[model samples]
Target chain A: MSEIKKDLLYTESHEWLEQQDDGHWRVGITDHAQAQLGELVFVELPGEGDELSQGDACGVVESVKAASDIYAPVGGEVTAINSDLEDSPDLVNTDCYGDGWLFAINVSDESELDELMDADAYTEFVDE
Target chain B: MSEARKTPLYDAHLAAGGQMTEFAGWLLPTRYTELMTEHHAVRRHAGMFDVSHMCIVDITGAEAAAFLRRLLANNIDKLEAPGKALYSCMLNEQGGILDDLIVYWLEADYYRLVVNAATAAKDLHWLQQQSQHFAAGKLQISQRSELALIALQGPEAEAQLLHQLPSLGAQIKALKPFSVLRDDHYCIARTGYTGEDGFEIMLDAAAATTFWQSLLDAGVTPCGLGARDTLRLEAGMSLYGQDMDESVTPLQCGLGWTVAWEPSERAFNGRAALQKQRDDGVAEKVVGLVLDQRNVLRSGYQVFSADDELLGVLTSGTFSPTICKPIGRARVNRNIGNEVMVEIRGKKIPARVVKPVFVRRGQIMPGIET
Candidate 1:
């Protein structure tokens, strides 16, 4: 069983949303997604200032077994990407919800967050 | 889903926390711990693998040697000693590879063959059909499904084996590559696919679990199919179904050296077609590709020439743990140059073409290093 953070918002695609102090949203893959992907060998991050749709493919996470696309949970403009992942991709495996956050974004529409699942709903969604 | 067959070491793999997956109709471990950790254990220390799913067949009678000579691409006459082993490919009538196997001359009238799990039945059928054409004497084929095979591979493989079975250490240590020693209950061979010093031991199925436990207690890491694939790929060893199959010939699959054309009079199965193929020319060849970027290369990726003409496709690809880079084998046009482009996810990435051997005996081979 994987840990589901109670305060975070999640997408059906497994990305998590964290509200940062700057009013922007911090995003990363959930614990369940990283566990299923195994050891991460390479991570392709979206560029800062890039605009993304709610369901757009934002980046890629590749393991020894296969590669998976990371989809945007909400429409936003990328504010900052996790540049540390370029040198060390396994951080996504070690701390998926913390330092492994993929990219931060400035939300274009606050209503998109209301469409996301809360922790309790996400836990049930992933379990199903 | 239909129930998959379990190996004798299935319980042992479960106890070791192996992630079980379906492979060749059998449930087997893909990895016990992490892929790279298990892979490095085989390169630096020692690792054990449960390869019992491989089919073992024993051929006997006065015509055994002659029967093999007619059926296989490699000459079995090379095995002069009792326990000598030879790696050969059983080809179809059209010179396409049926399966690659190791044949051991156990005695004057008996030889043993170990083949891939998925191709065992087909290979056996081909062997039986080909044996009907032999003129020397009667041939007997026995499938030994009662035996379990395990491989202990690495630089310290001998040491670990000696530590476990000390009484047989001296004799096993003296066994050269491609040689075997059989006792009442064990058949230990000095051969492996990981390009390392190792022994592939065959024992009774009933004793497999206990033997695996003992090896585990002796500190030999338990490896799975995941690490095994990476290690063999790094060593340039070809996989049965992926690298070559019924539609692919040895000439195109980088296995031409396994073919024996000697005694020009000897007519092996598919020899005529192979001879004709040799007389004309082979169209494609398998070569190693080292990706310049950090991108992961995978099978079915298209290879292109510098000017954007399609060349061939990758047969086996992986992130090589030992080299810490992405490497793959591709069957491409014979005229392909040193540099080629591999199309991955609609992006054409440049890769360097080189010999298939990236690493051998724990040492990195030349031209593969970044």
Candidate 2:
């Protein structure tokens, strides 16, 4: 089945967010989204400290077939970037939910999580 | 015009959970899963493509060979063997390409021609007209639209397809490249479009659905036209409309080598024009370009010199599955320099001009130095 981790939050654009120990939130593409995109060739993620609003274009993902924009799930400042993806983008294809996580962000507003989808809601949204 | 054409294996594609889309006027499978996934599957293992939309035509008569010698751009005298197939272009007298087709020598006076689907009607009309001028009753071109074709391609295609038809196992093994064999029930050709070694099978349209499902049951991954396009593009194979249109001559589209100008006596349509171009030094050559950067270069993109001079236009391009880089074929001025930059979204990306065929047998070619 599609990966819908209960502890995480989701975006309609198919990105997932998990709260880290720090004040930042870990962000990555859900398993369903990665599977739909296929093999990842190149990734263009924002650098650390890049400020972004909710729904802002934070990065880009280019697959062998097409390129897609990675939108910020919630407003935040990119606290950390996944440099591993620069050399091994296929990690996104292999483990989209775990080690393939995109980046971490220090949220500009924690209440924006309310606008994001929870596991159950995201499941229903994707299914529909 | 909105009414979509359906192939015999349409239901099979649906049953396999294929994403359906309209391609070349037919409602066909674009992908069973992700396009890249299916494309990679074909490169690593075996993938089955539903190519029944391709029209197969048969020519037979006392002077069939003679008629084809004049009807096609390539000489047919070389295909003396029964199982041999020859790739040739059907061109108008004005040197415009009508269609590039594969002709199989089935008998002394019989030949099988496979033409692209989009140009099937126009090809048929052209062939009919040519038949009348080149000793009418002595040649006959019959459009066999009732047959269905399935292209099983990739490394393991032969073994997988053999399990489906045990009787043709030995025949498949001995089949050479660009050759075909006709058994009691089917015509199996060792030809494919994916740059992999495989066979294209033709059978009764009614039997197509069952045969397609049987292949799937044999663990043959079902692919669609989307994968087919990327696969062919990577293989450096030309698409009829994109790479070489009616306005192009074989010499300019990297197909001049396929033109047989031997014997100095074989008279074919467009030969004079082609000879003139060849003698006058062809103005352009189709070259392969590998983008040095991450951005994908697409067709209609402007290819320019580093000095900002326009060199050519990209014809077909895609992110190569094997190479993991952007590659495209462009027709550029022969006088232009080797290294050129592609204008992608207003920025110039450096590209290297190298040999046309980029990937072969699941391996990306090396030494494409700028």
Candidate 3:
């Protein structure tokens, strides 16, 4: 079974949202998502300052077998992108929830976090 | 859903934590460990592959050679010596490739053929139908479903094989490439798809599991289809369905050398069509592509001229683990220049046209920049 952190909130599409220090949010794919994708070879990141809508495709992650789109969980402006992935995309497979964080977003409405699934709910969803 | 067939080593694959996938109607391992790890294992050390899904057929009787000469594009007469093998394609009347196979002359009257699994039934039917013309010679065709195949490949492959079966070291080491040495239970051939020195061993199905375990104990890493694909791609070898099919001829698929046109009186199937195409000139040819960027190239992607005019389509492609770069084979117009564009994900990326061989024998091929 894949690792699921209890402190993070998740979207149905597998992106995990971690609340940031300045009331912003850091987002990255969950461990389950990265495991399903195998070793990642390339990652196309959304540019900083770009506006993203909830449930929209923000970027793509490609492996040797296939390519998949990464979805945004909540609508917001992109505060920062993970520039480290440009050189080492396998970081997503190594430390998915830490240095592999895809991007940070300044949410237009922080209350959208309430609509996302909690760790327990997300784990149950993936199990089924 | 219909059930997929299982090979003799299916359980072994599952025991090794392999990810199972359906390939050509059989449940096979796609990968055991990470893709790059298994790929590098074969390049640096020895790796074993369970290729029992490939079909084996035995042909015997006085007419076997005569029937094959008329049916196959390659001349079977070249296998005059026992245990010699020849790679050839079974072509249709229209000069299209039916399937590519390796035929081994086991003895004066018996020849064995290893064909693709997906096209086994079709190939058998075609062979039977063509044998009618030589009824007086009396040929017998039998499928050897009870046998299993295993391939050991890499620079260290011969040493590993000799270590596991020390008794056969002399004979195995003496066997030349495309040559086979067989006892009652095992047929060991110095033949492999990977552009590395290796042996393809065929044995009774009952001995497969035990043999696989012994090889693993002898330090041969078990590889799956993922590594096999990347290795063959890097070696510039062609995959049957991906690189060529019923609609494509060998002349266009970079296999023109496999066709033998000697003894002008000997007429083979598709000879007329191939001769016509040769006279008229082939319009499109398959060539290798190397991406200038880090993006991965995949099959069915469009290839374009430098000025954005569509040139052709990518036939087979992958991120080459051995070369640590993206490489692919594409069928483009004959007049295409050295510099071309590949449309990946709606963006045209610049690429260079070079020989398909990115690596061979654990060394990078000449003219391919690392």
Candidate 4:
């Protein structure tokens, strides 16, 4: 089973959100997402100031085997992105939860956060 | 929609941690570890693939050679000696390519052809239909279902075969590229799609697992169709269905060289149509494109001229592992220039057009650089 981080919220589309100290939400795909995609070669990150609604397609991750869209789990304005992915997309496959965080979103609507899944729920969701 | 057929190596691939995926109606591994690793193994070292899914047809009888000469686009007489091999395209009457195949003249009155798996049924029907024009009973064509195929490729392919199957050392050592060496028990061809020095071995279906295990025991990496595709793409080889199908002709797909036109009297299948098309002029042809960008240029992507005219579409495409950039083959206008733009994800990405061949024998061929 792929690792699911506790103390983090996840969407059905597989983005994991970690609440930062500044109330910004750190976003990245879960380990399960990266493993299925396999050997990522490129990632198209959303613009830093782009506004996204909950569950909107925010970016794209392409691997040798397939390509997938990255979805926003909560409504927010993009603040920062893992610029390292521009050169080393494999980080998303190797260290998805740590160094491979995709972008940080400054919250505009906190209610969308309540709809995210916790570790236990996500574990059940993925298994199904 | 029927259940996918499993080759004899199905269980073996699963045992080796292969991630299975359905391809061309066969259940096969997409990869064991990762695709690039398998690709590099074949490039820098050695890799083996379970190619039993490829359909092999055996033909024999007094009229076998005559039958093939009329059935294939290339001249079968080119296989002047026993064990000689010829690559050809089986085309329809309208000059549309049915399939690209490799036929080996094992000996007089006996020939073996390896064709794409997805087109096997239709190809067999077409072969039977075309056999009617000749002396019917004098030509016998049958599928070789009892045999399994293994492709051992790379820089070390010959060395591994010599070391592992030491008994066939003499024949394996003397086997020329595109030729085969066979006895009652084994048929080995020095051919491959990856543009690497390799051997395609055919043996009893019962022995396939044992052969695969022995190759793994010899430390040869296990590769899958995923790597097979990337390797062929980098080598500028075309996939049958993607590059050309019933809707396209060989001349339009960069396979004009495979056609033999020297012997004017030799009227092969689709000869009249191809001759007419050549006379009329081929308006579009397949060319290689290289994009120095992160995103991929997948098949079906549109090509445009610098001034924004529609040129053509990519037939086969992938992110080239050898060059770390996106490279693909597109069927575009005959007047396409050195530079073009490809519409990828709604944006026009500029690309450089070069010769259709990208790599050969594990080395990047000239003109691939952007």
Best by TM-score: 4
Which lDDT tens digits does candidate 1 get at residues B149-191?
A: 9999999999988887778878887899999998898999999
The DockQ-derived docking category for candidate 1 is medium
Put down candidate 3 lDDT per residue, B81-141, tens digits, no spaces.
9989999988999999999999999998899999998888798899888878886557998
Better of 1 and 3 by lDDT: 1
Error of 3 at A93 (Å): 0.8
lDDT string for model 2 (B260-368, tens) is 8897798889888888888889889989999766656678998998899898899998777667678899999997666888997566888888888887788776755
* Candidate scoring better on lDDT of 2 and 3: 3
Error of 3 at B15 (Å): 0.9
Task: For candidate 1, give the lDDT of residue A128.
Answer: 91
Pairs of colliding residues, candidate 1: none
Chain B TM-scores per candidate, in order, are 0.98, 0.97, 0.98, 0.98
Which pairs clash in the backbone of model 3? none
Provide DockQ values for all models, in the order shown. 0.63, 0.30, 0.71, 0.74
Q: What are the per-residue Cα lDDT tens digits for candidate 4 across B1-370?
A: 9999999999999999999999989999999998999999999889999999999999899999999989999998988799999999999999999999999999999999999999999999999999898797899999999999999999999999998788989989999999999978789999998989999999999988998899999999999898999998888888998988988888999999999996999889899999999999999888999997787778999999999999999998888888898889999999988999999888899999988788888888876865
For candidate 2, what is the lDDT? 0.86
Q: Identify the superior model by lDDT, candidate 2 or candidate 4.
A: 4
For model 4, what TM-score is found for chain B? 0.98
Docking class of 4: medium
